[model samples]
Target chain A: MMNKKTAPVGVFDSGVGGLTVAREISRQLPDENIVYFGDTARVPYGSKSQNTIIRFSEQIIRFLKTKEVKAIVIACNTASALALDAVKDEFDIPILGVVIPGARAAVEATKNRKVGVVGTEATVQSGMYTKVIQGMNPEITVIEKACPLFVPLVEEGFKEHQVTEEVIEYYLESMRSTDIDAMILGCTHYPLLRSKIRAYMGDKIQIVNPAYETAMDLKCLLEENDMANDGTEGQHSNYSFYVSDAAEKFRKFANTVMPFDVPITNVVNIEGY
Target chain B: MMNKKTAPVGVFDSGVGGLTVAREISRQLPDENIVYFGDTARVPYGSKSQNTIIRFSEQIIRFLKTKEVKAIVIACNTASALALDAVKDEFDIPILGVVIPGARAAVEATKNRKVGVVGTEATVQSGMYTKVIQGMNPEITVIEKACPLFVPLVEEGFKEHQVTEEVIEYYLESMRSTDIDAMILGCTHYPLLRSKIRAYMGDKIQIVNPAYETAMDLKCLLEENDMANDGTEGQHSNYSFYVSDAAEKFRKFANTVMPFDVPITNVVNIEGY
Candidate 1:
């Protein structure tokens, strides 16, 4: 049997947006086991209140702890902005949020030192990006736009719809005026709207998606902590999913978002935990 | 004090979209008190799975029951489509789902017996409109397009932007080909987009909003059941709000949508109750 040190890394989001991060993690760390939980039942945490999002995050982290995860990744941007600080205090394990990773990446990607951000209203209003960016590079100027509709558009599978394009155009119009060289997709779901947003914003604006960068950061954290899975020949890593509500939709969404299929289960009642 | 029977009616939606319905209810029954709950914590129920939406609806209804609501109105179209039956069975009070009321209105409003419908994916997929409209008038031809982005746009408060107009044009273009005589704003948030929709669909297409009709229905039900708040001299009614998430955002949204301000409170952890 493989050593217990190869315990799975737990990741969770309000819905499928986390899959973007999960997929990146899977690709970058093929040897490590991954466990994902999508709160498909009660999604769109972006619009929810700080306290409510914190409570929900606590429940999800507690459930993940039961699985003995080595570390946790708050793949949802809303959770990252509102709940990450409180979560780090309550839990002993190391937790990584998508914001800083994306922020750092945006800093590196921007040539003009002027950046734009698009996320859910809560995330945008929290000024998380502005604070994070300015903390690292005080010279950089940040403009933030809340593309609240992007999440719903993505969830409804309007990935390529013309209306989606128009909506993205509407949301990005504010950014275009700022002459931003890079735009950080502050919401996990915003990445799905990449092509549409890019088409409207044109090729000049470099879009920074945190999911990929977060995956890289997770790998670095694992190696630095000596928690990376050891080579166990003939053993393949698998992913299991748990959702607060509606396992079936989570399963279907899992198939749609990620390249590989994973087993998804519905807990229905998270408060029970 | 007025008799306890004149207690405020409880209304809820996944988010601020229900404000449209709430506004109508307040306008029609000026003297009646209202208690509104916007599950701003986990909004955009249209994209979630049926079972998860049911759970959310159940939790919101349970919360409303604690308020001792005289009647419950689900001002959200997604809940009306997916959770209405389950909610009706779970609670004994006069529970009204917006689907039937809206469908009935659409059937009545169409001059050419040709109607178009636009809403979230779940609302359109549920076929609730087809079933309800056919039951009312079998000969009426219903053309449905799931304009999923509309909810987020309304929530984001982009009701009158150029991009909003573009999005409306893109979404309503489908209705133009069908020559729809009436277009039902299937989602509660949709009525907020009525001006844009009306502009796109032109004067020939009658716009049907269930929020308006539902308010009317509530008045009739209250009067018939002898639960109407007496509008006699020296009578004043008040409203209290409970949201699953941000009290601040809900308060701001309430002020914008309601004719007058009402008190709002955040119920921190009411899920699964």
Candidate 2:
């Protein structure tokens, strides 16, 4: 039997958008197995209410626990912002979310006190990032904007298209006006458009991706807690992907956004959990 | 108790975008009452599997029947394309979907027998428009392109912005190459960007707004079935809106898309049904 330390880590998101986070985690921790669940049935958590987001997160965590995961990562930014607080204590294992790590990294990177955030409307509206940044340093200023079109643009395979560039310029023009030195890519989908966003915002502005920071935090937590999969052999990792609806569509999208070819995805009835 | 004919019509979509269809319905049937449901929690039905959509539509219809609605209008194009057939026969009320009416209108209006369609990926993927048009006239040519960005662009309030114009041009440039005479606004949300879409496609190409055609069909159905509220007393019509997620966000969006001020919206737990 495999040791408990060799058990797979769990990652959950509202949809395929969070594969970016899962990708970053896999890149940093190649020895650890991963089981990813995407709630494609109730996606775009950014627009949903805090209560609904929390309830959905609880159900997903319950389902993930059944998979024998060692740790859980709230890969969906909205879930990280709104649901992580209520459910963190429900499980004995370490739980990490994208929001706190991202806020921390942004504070460390900003030369100037002013920082900018661009995410889905619900993430920005929750004021979670702003509160975290302000909690770390009382005087640090935060400007948050909801760039709703970024997710759809990424999903539409328009990451570097001219239309995408135009849309980026349109959403980020106001962020440029604040003279902020760093901008947090608050939504995971925004990282796919990093090149266009970087080009439009110029070199002076640092783009803080939460996926990278979240992965770093997970690495540190695993090492500190002695949960690292150090005894695992040289075999390549197998990533199990699951979605609540449309496995074929999820597989097709996973192919586009993932670093490697997406293997077969299983469609789970998450609502039944 | 309200008379059967005086009861409100129930219109439903995955989100507030369906208010465009509701607005059109109210325009054509000024005397009729309306009860609209926006399933903001599980929006963008375009990406979900057929089973999930059918299940969702059934839940919404069950809720609408409880509201004493005389008929049900699948104001969402995705729902119309995917779920209407599964539930239409199950209900005793006059059930109408936007797809068949839009397809019929496009077939009737096309002079060159070549028609184009622009909608969300799911609608285009369903090929409902192509099947209906070709079924009506086998000689006619049908071309469908999924303009995924249009809905988000409208939601971002970029309807008249230059960026929107650029995005529109980007998506429709391929359609421009074809000798199509008319284009179907396959998604209900597309009507909000009607002016920009029309300007880009030019007057020689007719842009068929399914919302308008859907309203016309509803008007004809009401009159033919003697369900019209003709003998009702002189009182302002009431519009009741419901959402499965954030009511405030739905209200804000409803104000932008609908011509009149939005009424109070009740946030329902749609999963309960």
lDDT of 1 at A207: 89
Error (Å) of candidate 1 at residue A182 is: 4.9
lDDT of 1 by residue, A171-245 (tens): 677778778999998988887777778888999989899998999999899999888887565588878888876
lDDT of 1 by residue, B134-206 (tens): 8999999988888876766666667787767877777777778787788788888777777878877788778
Which ranges in model 1 have alpha carbons more than 4 Å from their true place? A1-3, A107-117, A137-143, A156-183, A193-207, A264-268, B1-4, B264-268
TM-score of chain B of each: 0.94, 0.94
DockQ (Cα-based) for each candidate:
0.55, 0.73
Clashing pairs in 1: none
Q: Predicted chain A of model 2: TM-score relative to the true chain A?
A: 0.95
Candidate 2 C-alpha error for residue B130, in Å: 1.6
Q: TM-score, chain A, per candidate? A: 0.96, 0.95
